[model samples]
Target: MLCAVVLNAAQAASAQSVVVQPAVQVRSVTTNNVSFAEAEVARSDSVLIVTPRLDVLTVNPGYRLNASLAADAVTYLGRSQADRLLPRAQADLTAQLVERWLFVDGRLSADTTAGNPFGVLEDESSTIFNRTTVYRQRISPYVERELSPRERLQLRTDHSWFQNRNAGGTDTRIDTYLLSQRASYELRPQPLGLRAEYTRDSSDYSNLPDSSVLFETARLSAMYEAAPQLVLTLTAGSDHARYSGIDQRETLRGFGLRWEPSERTSVGALVEKRFFGTGWAVNLAHRAPFLVLNADMQRRSTTYAAQVAALPAGGDVAQLLDSLLSTRITNPVERATAVQQLIAQRGLPATLASALDLFSPSAQLLNSASLSAALLGVRHTITLRGFYDRTEDLIGVNPPPLFSSNARQYGASLGMTRRLQPDATADFSLTRSRVVGFGTNAGVVTNNLSVRFGASRQLSLRTTVSAALRRQWVDSTAVTNANQTALSFGLLHRF
Candidate 1:
């Protein structure tokens, strides 16, 4: 979700059960340069960061609740401007109000980050150039009712807001809301079904009101299962959008297929005719005991507000929920066996990694594709990923006609994790990316390499000492080359 995959064996080893818990971490970090710049502009600093985290889980017969909360207090030596206190929290709830009749699901989250790169908030690190503070919050709720044994109805609503203030005293804000309803019915005894959905979306911008938009869409779909492993679908829809008092409408038709010949392999594709042009989407995935691969491509029209709201934060919340659910097995041996059963039973691909790119605050037609693969072994792991994206009808500073331009981006990363001993582990990764803007903006290429060595040992029954070293590099158009080195030591106590 953060444009990168972080495989932590340590987390996997500790994810045995879900229970209410509180953890405290006190860390001290020393860095040679925190500005992510060359020696001429770099500044050295020492910071003490303390994080208090809490995990709450309540699982009952008819409802489940999961929540996480953390607060970071950062103190910088020599009175630097980068010192601040930050709080982040996320919560998810699912409840069955009436047995087999009514259901409710909801999610709420709030976080702060450094900047918005691809309409998503990018995490803060030593290599980040901009220090802008962006805060985001989102709330989504869904309700479902069983109309009959073979019929169902659902309603969903989402609200999100984002506010950011740059170092240069510039502030921006965006608000978005969406409401949708879906109905599904089984058409026959066989594997045939019909579904209809209607949605309305509205977005508002404090700085760019002209860029705000209101859109509505209605879709009808039919699906037939030809075999246990294959299914076919057809969809017809209409979309209407209004921007700055201008209305545009389009008719959409699409056909799709889903094929999974084996438990470890899957392929899906959809081709559609729309107002902008012909659009297509494809997905392919395969998984094995030691390897996993996923790839996808899509073309569509979207707004910046929608993209931002859809983007994930630092981690994959859905995957985290899955992991938490999987931890219900309290016995160690049973938990291990359950993991194997899950691996064998899983039929869907994992979430794809995020791509590094910039997003504009305007309605645009976009084409994007990505591929990610990973190999896991008893003691080592390897990962590779790449992506490409292009956009048209980009909004510009001048009014009237917007700029029609495209950007190309591609990147790959290789990483390996090894265990030195029972209590020590080390890993290293290298990533390279190139972004070229065709019509506007300067082209930039970036290379980043990082290595971390972590050692943890128990000091007592409930205390541990952990130390790590992280080194990173960055090359960008704004800054030719820069390097950062950091050493961190932490003490953790669990209760």
Candidate 2:
């Protein structure tokens, strides 16, 4: 359905001149796993997956469009119940409906993944890597109008849905929606600005009615530019929520400052007070010739669906920097080399070079802090990062036997990546996490180590062969001791 929609939109835009690109891939994978239970009673499986992808881009003076679609067909060698096809699609559109006065933006995406391991797309380290698949869809639309030269108005809405089947042979569904509007105006035309905004969020769960929530918030803010490198902001707000037929209201106020004294350094801080508690946040970042640093701390109240919605929408900063560097080089191999050289020259930290996939979303209010640093070398890179989080009223199992309790989590990771040759690269990482204060799974520890070596060589004008081996280990109270290993080889021909 999503592919059809994207194709139709592309066809319509092609009438006015649009660009389209397509790609295809075929891969074979074999894996052995000893999951949960005793190590002696593990399971192994072999599978093959084939994928085809398409990308379309349309651009003009007043409008732009980008869309991509990929379909994956999986076949199990001896397990007929674990074979299925999945489709992933994404689309983004922006248009200037009425010159510079009015604009529109929209995005749509759909994905399918295994429910265990928190539906992570590429990793299989969960205790129960079941065959059941979960499907998720998201849509966002936004509009903005220029009320005046120094004033603007905007409106945005988001809708997301999740569907899956549980072990009890029942279907589960979750729906979430968000609506917001904002108006901003310059107060004195000299670094003074004022803004007002309103936001509403709603979440509904088919199997967990008591967990549903509806919340509304309104805020007014004032900003002053103290100097060329400093700015201050103050905000006052109120929140009203309805949960399980109970209504509650709270007052909120906050102060913030942003300072950037140099080209390579920046600092930000915010302190807020609310009826339920006081929250504070801080961020510091610096880039040097040989090192990069980033640190942050935050305290906030959020629900499960809201947290999921707040996940990063784009790739990490490292990937963004690589893309920017790629535009300067025409050759694909040279672009990769230039990106690595630029990363080393700019002292891009190790923590920012790779995505932080350790954190897990929980349906609880929490306070968290993290620090990451990266050291770039001539031919190698090293990174270190740590995080700590404390959750309030953590939700556990069901409500019958009461398995919910508060918990604290902390973790650290160390990683290194090296260029073995012009066409070969190697990466290694080790991570450890611990959870405490939970009811049954108190003092649970998980450790994972992964290493991969990849090389590519052209066989013909449009063909290449690549191979890799991956090993992972998971140790936890829930999963006991489990080990997984996989070796894969693929042949690709692009046109």
Candidate 3:
């Protein structure tokens, strides 16, 4: 069913509208012999302006701007009596400048929140309130300028800063800046083009033992259509990174190509060389009717180096040989060897460097594969897929119970996705994974089950629900170590 209403009686040539809405949510959690529930109610209001004339701001440009301002506040159960539910506010303005070559956009947002852990407060385990309000604000501004015909240049800069103050005596701040320059050239229209870009990144940290880090990257690429049905692309780039106060340096050189013969077929490959870095990898994937497969073969090795921020012990001595023998100094501007820079980079202290070998990069090999197939037939409504995968990482996040000389993972999965209706669908999947650590501890195995249901009616209404369950165990522990469950539901309406 469709309903349409039209009114042409507005007195002005341009008009605006304001919209207000509200919502409420309830939540519950059960974990590790602990169960809790909470409810929250929120109110939101928004004002929007619609310009009927194309030239609402300036008659010469012939454009319109949509601007909106919104604010919301929510109150949740269980909180300190002195605390207040601070409201969040936002403002947006999208302006069309010159209607084409140049445009501007801006947005601002702010919000606050409270603390958690009810038991800690009730039992007086700690004297602290464990909660404090934080203020977050941001703004984004951009401009575009056209350089010439057949060739164009673009420059963009972004700046952001954050400050955090604790109720106690703790305080911290962050400032970030980014700049990008890009140029696009049409060798023979857009079908054949060349592109180049360069970017620089720097970070300075202060507080306990202040430090700074910086990096520069540049890339050049060309893409062209060899045939109406075939397209090819190639790209090359390099990156140099320097750790802040540590004065440590890392660099990477990479090149790759991608080819697409038809809408149904594609292939791509890439290789990279690194300086004072980890390792390298290879990846590949292909798709076909009734069956789809992807595989990745990779090797990675990193030194058991200590954190530069907390240097403990010197790592394997082989790093000295790797650095002196492998890395070559090359000048970017002169395109010549620059052994002086290499010697300078080597002078920095390794204490504040990665726990890995400072002189050499670690190496590791990893492989993974996955597959899926159309269940019965193309005309058959049901689809089925099965996938298997594995990974090999030398280090684990946890050193003790999860300790390993090399970590290995294995998994297999089965999935069924079906169309229940033109506008609705459902899917179910199950997967099992096993992880074996190189250490003496027992390996772990986990099984995951999930289901999803979704419905959509164009722009009017949509609903989706997904649920997951999992069981995990370690080879040494014989119990149902952990049983987990989760679910999410969402609904959206447009008018």
Candidate 4:
């Protein structure tokens, strides 16, 4: 259905430009503690991983597509029964249906993740029994209209679905639908505006009927330009929510401010009163010649599926640095290479940052704060990131074991990189995290620590080689403590 929709929309567009990239990677891993065991057990293992991947990008006046797909084949030396194949993919499409008036956005993704937050964390090449594959898709179509020079309107509808493949009877399926309408009018010279918006969101579950939820909201906002670079907003709204066969209503009032003193800095904040209590959000970003920083904080009612879908495509550090480098680098290939080199030197993931997702089928009151900063010197690079979060299940106490009831998690990571030569780089990183659960799982706590050292060299224009040594330790009240050390060598080639 998604392919058909995109093809039909593309028929009305002009000529299209497309690019395809294919790559292969091989890695050899050796570990003394294959199962992250305690008691100084010497269970050694050797593993081999082969991966083939493809990326596609297409652009036209009326449509665009971006996709990445990969398959990883893992072999456990002398343990054929433990070998496995893993698949991963992410794709997104945007099409303009009626010039600039109608448009559609679609996304699809599949990956494997831990089903339980307290489960042991292991590398992708090493399989764990508590992992599950997740599939998600979403489509949204909207209409944008300029009623007049100072008036505008937008109407949109979204449909999303999420599914889990698990043998533990936690196989869940969810369908979500949303409808929204917004209109605004502004007095140009007066620098004042009034906007009204309405939204209705509904979710259905296949195995958890009682967890279904529906929300309806209507709001009116007034904005005033306090200064040339500052804006203030006041909003009043009402919310109606239905969950667990219960209906509830709440009054909403919010105040917001946006400050953009310069092109390199931006700050925005919002504070509101809602059903559970006060909800707040803050965002700050600043970019300098050799430094990039971003921070945000928010508290809201959300589901795990929604959060998963909103993850950044290229990771936190990579995305921010990419945006900052865009103005300095013009060629696409050069910019991408620069981004990769920066990530490799800093010991950062090219994808999303690591986190312990407290997966839940029902709604949760989530409060989270995160900060990331990077400094680039002539031959040295330093990166730091920190995050804190608290989650409370909205469905009530005594929930299923797979669902998170109440939990607090906090973590931080610091990395340093140095250029050994023109084509060689080395890096070191340390990460720490702690998780504590309340309510039914009261007194359960887990602490994790990781240290790694890595070095990489560019073998040729299309090939690169790298080696890394990592040590991981885990101390938990819910499970036995563990210590593991792994050494790996990898080669990647592109075509």
Candidate 5:
């Protein structure tokens, strides 16, 4: 269905450009702790992995698309775990249905997720049994109309589905629907504007029908332009919600400010009072000729699927590096490809600050903050990433005792890469993370520290060779402490 939508949208375009890229990699991995257990009980193993990927991109006046599919075939020489196949895919598409009046956005993604937050964490090549594949799809269509020179209206509807492929009696299929409307009118020649908005959101769980939720909100706001680059707003709203067989009515009052002094810098913040007490969000971003910085904080009631969808397909590190190189790379397609090449050449991680996201049927009040920055020099690149997350389960039906309440996780990483030659580079990184659970899981804590060094060289325009060495240490109060050392070598070819 989604492919049909893209094809239909492309047919309406006057001009279109398409590109497909295919690549493959062969890797040899050696690890001393195959099961990530205490050294006394650990076993060694040799693993071989083959990965193949394909990416497709299309762009035109009426539509745009970026998609990729990949799979990992893993084989173990030593019998610590069985062989497995891991598949991953992601797609993002936006199309103009009727020029400026109608538009549609669609997304699809699939990946493996941890079954238990406290379980051993390892890469896809590692034979980890406590993992499951998750898939999510979303589509949104919206209408926009210009009522006058200073007035506009927008109406939109969004539908999404979340499925857990190996769900064990839990809610395996979830559907979410949302409807929203907004209207704004600005007084001509004056710095005043008024806006009205309304939204309705519903979520249904196939296996747990009683756990569904409906939320409705109506809001009004008045905005004043304080300066050419600054705006201040005051808002009032009401919410009617039903969850966990309970109903709620709340008044919402908020204030917000936005400052965009230049195209390279922006800052925004909002504070509101809701049924869950004080709620707020803040964002800051700045781009320079040689650096990029971004930081954000948010608190809201959301599902794990929603959080996963909001993240960049390539992760935070890729997202930051893409921004850092935006000025140097103007074309979107070229920039995206360049970002991936840099990540491979510099040994940068695809992801840096992901939390232990376990499956849950109920909603959660999540408080999260993240900061990322990249510095680019003539022959060197430096990156920093940090994140903190605290989640409290809300409206949980028959929640597991160990994960029924609050969980807190925080981590940080720093990496540096230096160019050794025109086609070779060396890099080093250090990372530390910790997680703590509350309530029935109180006193349960885990800490991880990792150090890595790697080097990569381009053998040709379409081939590369790389090697890496890593050591990791784990300290846990709920499980036995352990340490592991791993080495990897790989060859990649693109065609």
Candidate 6:
């Protein structure tokens, strides 16, 4: 019970739903099946928390092979028509070394989403939002050792290489150069915890149009349950990120609190504040069996940067800069010049220039604010439900924007669910999205409609279908939005 509270607090602390990495400001999970990032967010990305057993395989004293396939269309955004798919068919080999002191095991997996970078692989895969296909030609290997029942250590690794991608687009083609390590420890006698991780992502971009950004990361966190109804947590971390041949450092310092009043009632708040000249935000949330509510108000300010060969590179690092930016090497100094020329030759886009212009001193409020509320109920007989939330986001130019130039987002959503049996259910929902801002795409309207059917019992099969349409009141060179619709079918088995 205490462990549950601590986990909830951790999610409340890391609620942005976005992490800026060297490769990209990843909004969703990529290759790692285990969603460390999403776990920090407010919700569980996994559709099925437990997979039911169909049959069991036991070889001699310490070996087993279990098989099953499952899929579901998992979406973070209520309006996103693009959902993920995961059809997992796997087997395992286990061996016992000592009574309970130590043992090692490995597994191999095959998935439908192994190629086609933009392909949808899982109907309920956690990486659905990324829209990237991850595949392997042969068997994948994993090793596990038991340190104790409550606390354990693990070392797992995998390698991949992608092929044949359209160059007119972005990051494609993978290289077998990335390696990662993870370790987790459970605090004794109480629900407390600590974790550390490091990784090197060096995928090649030869098949794509963008440069491959290598990501190196280090992180640590501590958490504790302060009371039966509340939990507190602290996190500190740093990332040395390199992108487009340029290096930048990202630091983190955050804290959070969560309060659960009863089995059916809970409230949460989080503060993610950074030391850099960046920005910070606080999130508040409340939930119940039949109702859930959320509100987010955040502000971020950025500096407008300019580069000139005439500007002094003066500093103790000048010697190092000279060596790093040699003609033979693709370095920051040289790349800065090329980017400067590009901005000068074409003249930077007005919209972007205006966004960067926020850095200038302004008397307006630098804080963005909004409110959201949603309600849902089910009679348990027919399985009926509905929900809605509204928020006003002023994100354009610092806070208070131009007063007249502010970006306001208004969203309204309604949904319902029904049960066909004790094991099968169906859901249907419709959503409307509107945005008012300074850009040409401002004052836009988007509508999303969807339906889903699921089975949670034996011979599991789940599927969902949805579509989205976006319309802009004013014409713009950028995409107004794309019309998307997808369907999925999946099965899961366990032993």
Best by TM-score: 5
> Once superposed on the true structure, which residue ranges of model 3 sit more than 4 Å away at CA?
1-32, 35-95, 104-149, 160-194, 204-209, 219-239, 245-255, 258-481, 485-495
lDDT of 6 by residue, 13-81 (tens): 443122111110012222322222222332333222222222223333333333323333344443323
lDDT of each: 0.57, 0.56, 0.31, 0.72, 0.74, 0.33
Tell me the spans in candidate 6 whose CA falls farther than 4 Å from its real position.
1-178, 185-210, 217-225, 229-231, 235-238, 249-252, 257-428, 431-495
What value of lDDT does candidate 6 attain over all alpha carbons?
0.33
Q: Where's the lowest-lDDT run of ten residues in candidate 2?
A: 352-361
User: What pairs collide in candidate 1?
Assistant: none
Candidate 3 TM-score, C-alpha based? 0.41
Highest lDDT: which candidate?
Answer: 5
Q: What tens digits encode model 3's per-residue C-alpha lDDT throughout 206-319?
A: 242322334456666676767664445565666654442223334445555556565545666555554434333444434444333333443332221111111121121122
TM-score of 1: 0.77
Q: Can you give the lDDT of residue 143 in candidate 6?
A: 40
Q: Which portions of model 4 show Cα errors greater than 4 Å?
A: 1-5, 8-14, 40-42, 123-130, 146-149, 166-189, 313-315, 330-347, 352-354, 396-402
TM-scores of all predicted structures: 0.77, 0.74, 0.41, 0.89, 0.90, 0.37
lDDT of 2 by residue, 1-495 (tens): 344345545555645446565656666666675232346765666667777877666765556676767767777664733667767666777665555655555666655433432111133222224434444456554567667777777776666665544311224343444333343333422488777778777766554446655667787878888998788989899977665455768997999988999977899999887534787889987776557677888886655456445543121335334444443454544544455334333223222212222121223556778787666566676677778766654333424212232456666666566656543445555565555555443554444444444444445544555565666665554445666676766665555
lDDT pick, better of 3 and 5: 5
Model 6 lDDT, residue 103, Cα? 39
Worst 10 residues of 1 by lDDT: 1-10
Listed per candidate, the RMSD to the true structure in angstroms reads 8.0, 6.2, 18.8, 3.2, 3.1, 21.4
Lowest lDDT sum, 10 consecutive residues, model 6, at 349-358
